[model samples]
Target: MTKRKNNNKLELIVAFSWVLEKVCDSEFSLLLPLSFFIIEFVIAIFLFFQFSKEEEEGVEVAAEEVSEEYTFQHTLAGKLWTENSFNSTAFKSTILNAWKLKNPVEIQDLSKNLFLFKFSMKRDLEYILRSGPWSFYRALLVLERVTGEEQPSDLTMHFDTFWVRIYELPLMLLSEVIAKKLGNIFGSYEEMDLKDAHRIGTFLRIKVTIDLRNPLKRGTVVKFKEKNRRDHFKYERLPTFCFIYGRIRHQLKDCEAFEDLNEEGFEDIEEQELSYGQWLRASPLPKVIEDQKKRDSSSGTCSKNIFNVSSGQSRCKTKEK
Candidate 1:
C-alpha cells in the first residue's frame, strides 16, 4: 500500500510539469505578435508629426517672401495700351501735359511697348491711369492700369474679342431677332455676326461667344419661344480660329484670308445689321478694310499668309489636302 501511494504522487507531479510548459509556450506566442504591432504603431506616429512640421516651415518661408514684395510693388507699377508706337519721351510729355504730376521723376522706358512706366508718387500713378483713353493720331488707348511687375508685361493674358458660330436659323432673319436670341443664351456679347451659308440649302448661321471655359459640347440645344410655340436651335464650337491661319493674335475674320469680310458684314454694336442679301454681301473688300490693311502694314502687323478662296486658292488647303 505504501509503494502504490508513492507511484500515484509521482504521476501527479509529471502531469503538472507538462501543463506548465504548454502555458508558457502559449503566452510567448501572443506576446511576440503584440510587441511587433506596438513598435509599428509608434513608428507611424513619429513620421506623421515629422511631415506636419516640415509643411508648417515651408508656409512660413513663403509668407515672409510675399510680405517683403508687397510694399514696393504697387508704387513701382504702371501699364499702358495704345495703337501708337511706344516712345518714352513722347509718353512722359503727354502725361505731363495732360495731368497733375507729383515729383514727376524722369521716366524709364520699361518696354518698347509702353507696358510699364516708372512713377514717384501714388497719386500720379492713379491720376495717369484714370486720365481718359489718351489718343494719338486716330488711335485710342485700350488699356491702362497699375501693375506690379518689374519687367514690362500685359496685365492680363487674353484676347479682347473672340468669334463663335450659331447653327441653323431662318433665312435672312432680322438682326434684332438674332440679338434677342443671342442675348438669351450668352451674356454680354459684342455684336451679332452673320455668315451667308455658302454651303447648299443653308441660308444663314448665328454664332455666340463662349469665353474662358470649355465650349458647349456638340449638339447642345437652345430653345427660343415664339407665340406659345418652341423652336430649338442647336449650336457647337467653331474650330480654334488660329488653327486655320496657323498663327496667333488674329481670329478668322481679322485674318487676311477674310479680307473679303467687310465691316458691313458685321452688325454694328450701336446698330445691328438691318438689311438682307445685298446687306449681307460686302462690296469687294471695302475701303475701311483696305485702310485697316494699310495701317497694319505700317505697324508691321500683316497676316503672314492668305488662305481664302478669293486669293484664287489657299496655300493652307493645298498643303493639308
Candidate 2:
C-alpha cells in the first residue's frame, strides 16, 4: 500500500511540471510580440519629435532673415524726398523745386528712362511728407531715380518755406497754368490734393521747380495772392471776359452766372448707362401698383364727369322738346 501511494505522488509531480512549462511558454509568446510593438512605437515617437524640432528651427531662421533683409532695404529719406506731399503747399513746393533742380538732365532726356525715376522720387517724397516718418523707409525702397544713399546728399531734410510776393499778374497766374502744363507734359503725374487751394499751390510749386530748376537762384521767395484771381474785378473788364468769367466761376464754386446757364436742371443729373436693355428692369413693384391705383382713381373721376355732362345734355334736349 505504501509503495502504491508513493508511485501515485510521483505521477502527480510529473503532471504539475508539464502544466507549469506550458503556462510559461504561453506567457513568453504573448510578451515577445508586445515587446516588439513597444520598440517600434518608441522609435516612431522619437523620429516625430526630431522632425518637428528641425522644422521649428528652420521657420525661426527664415523669419529672422526676412526681418533683417527688410531693415537693410527700407530707408526713411526716400519717402520724404520722393513721394508727393499733402500737408503744407509751401512745403511741397520747396521739396519739388529741390528735386527738379537736382534732376534736370533726366527731365530734358526724351528717352524717358530717367523720367520714370524722377517721377518716382517725386511721388516718394510726397508720400513721406503726407504719411510722416513711418512710411519714410518704405517709400525709399520704391524710389527709382534716387537711391537711399543719395537722398541725404540731395535733400535739405527739413521743412522750411520762404514766402515772397510777386507784382507781375502773369507770374502770379504762372504757377497754376504751369502746373497744368507740367502735368500734361508728364503723363505719369497725378494731382492728389483735393482742396482747390492746396491743389493749386502744390501744382504751382511743381511748375516753378520745372521752369526754374534752381528756385533759390530764381529767388526762393514767392508771393502768391491771398485771394485768387476771381476776387479781382478787373478780370471781368477784359474783352475775353466771358472765358475768364467762366473759369473763375468754376473755381469759386458759387457763380450766379453759372447757375443761370444751367437752367435746364442738368447740372445735378445722375447718368446711368446700360450696355443692354432688359425687358424687365428692377424697380419697386409696390410703387408701380400704388401709381396705377392713383391713375385709376383719376380716370374714375373723369368718367363720372363725362356721364354727368351727357345726362345733363339729354335732360336739356327733353326740356327743349
Candidate 3:
C-alpha cells in the first residue's frame, strides 16, 4: 500500500515536470502573464516537497515492517569454508536433504559462499546449530546463530561447536571438573556427559567451541604423581580438515603448505608424513543409543533409562500397563 502511494506521488512529479517543460519550451508561453508562470512554479514546488516528505515516511514504515517480519531470532549466519564458488541451488537442495528439517527453512544466499538460514521454528534452528558443524561437498559450513544488531557479513564464523571426545584419561580423573579442564584445552567447554565419569567408556564426550583458524589440537600431555601421560583427542562428526596443516578450514590438497612443499622439491611426501590423520575423528555412538535418540525425538519424550552411578549400570524404568 505504501509503495503504491509512493509510486503515485512519483508519477505526479513526472507529470508536473513534463507539463512545466512543455510550457517553457512552447512558443505560446510568451503570451502568458508573469503571475501565471510564478503560480505554476509554486504549485510544483509545493507538490515536490510534499512528495519528498511522504516518500521519506514511507521508507521508514517499510523498514519497520521488514524489521518486524524478520526478527532473526531463529536465524543462522553461515559461510562455507572454501575458496571455490558454490551453486546456491545445489547447496539449498543439499541442506534440505541433509537437515530433513520439520519446519520450513528460508535460505538466503549472501554471495561469496555466505548464507542466512531463517527457520520457521526455534526448535529447528537449535537442532541444526547443535548438530553441526555441517558440510557441503566436503567444505565445512561455519555457522553462527544470529544475535543482536550484527549484519550477516559481520557475524563471526571462526568458532564452531563440536563434540570432542577425551581419550585415555585416568579413571580417577574422569569427573566433571577434570572434563571441563581438559575440554578447555581445545576451546571454550560447552557441555559434557555427566554419567561418563561413572561408566568405563572408550572416551569422555564433551562439547567445545573450536577455533577453525587454529590448528586442530591432537592431544594434551598431563602429569599425575610425577608421571606424565598423553591423552588423545577425537572430534565427532568431524568434517574435512587440512592434514598438511591440521586446520579445519580446508582440505590438504587446497592447503598452501602443500603447494610450498611441492615448490621445495618435496612433492613425494606420503600421507603418513602429514601432521594429522583420520584418527582425529571419533567413532559413532552405539547403534542402540542412536536408535533410542531417534525414538525420543519422534515421540517428543526423553524416556531413556537412568544410569545408576553407584551400581555402574543403566537402570531402565518400565512403564505400568
* Native-to-model Cα distance after best TM-score fit, residue 10 in candidate 3, in Å: 45
Structure candidate 3, residue pairs in collision: none
TM-score of each: 0.28, 0.18, 0.68
On residues 1-321, what C-alpha lDDT tens digit does candidate 2 reach at each position? 446444655665566556546655885655555555654565455444443333556633444344443232222332233323323344334434433322221222212111122333444345333322121211111122234335233534322111111122343454445345433332222332122223233123221111111112211222355643321111001111011132210211233454554555544522222111111111211243334444545533211111111111111101112
lDDT of 1 by residue, 1-321 (tens): 446444654565466446546645775655555555554565455444543434556633454456553344335333342223656677667655544443664455555444444566665555444323233332223233443433444444222222233445444543546555654454345554332333322322343433322323223343445423223333221122222232223333444644354555444222232111111111232244345445444633323121121111111111112
Pairs of residues at least 3 apart in sequence or in different chains that clash in candidate 1? 165-207, 166-206, 166-207
Worst 10 residues of 3 by lDDT: 306-315
Error of 1 at 135 (Å): 2.9
Distance from true location, Cα of 173 in model 2, Å? 5.3
Query: Is 1 or 2 the stronger prediction by lDDT?
Result: 1
| Candidate 3 displacement at residue 315 in angstroms | 24
- TM-score of model number 1: 0.28
lDDT, candidate 3, 152-171, per-residue tens: 55765888888777888777
TM-score of candidate 2 relative to the true fold: 0.18
Whole-model Cα lDDT of every candidate shown, in order: 0.39, 0.30, 0.72
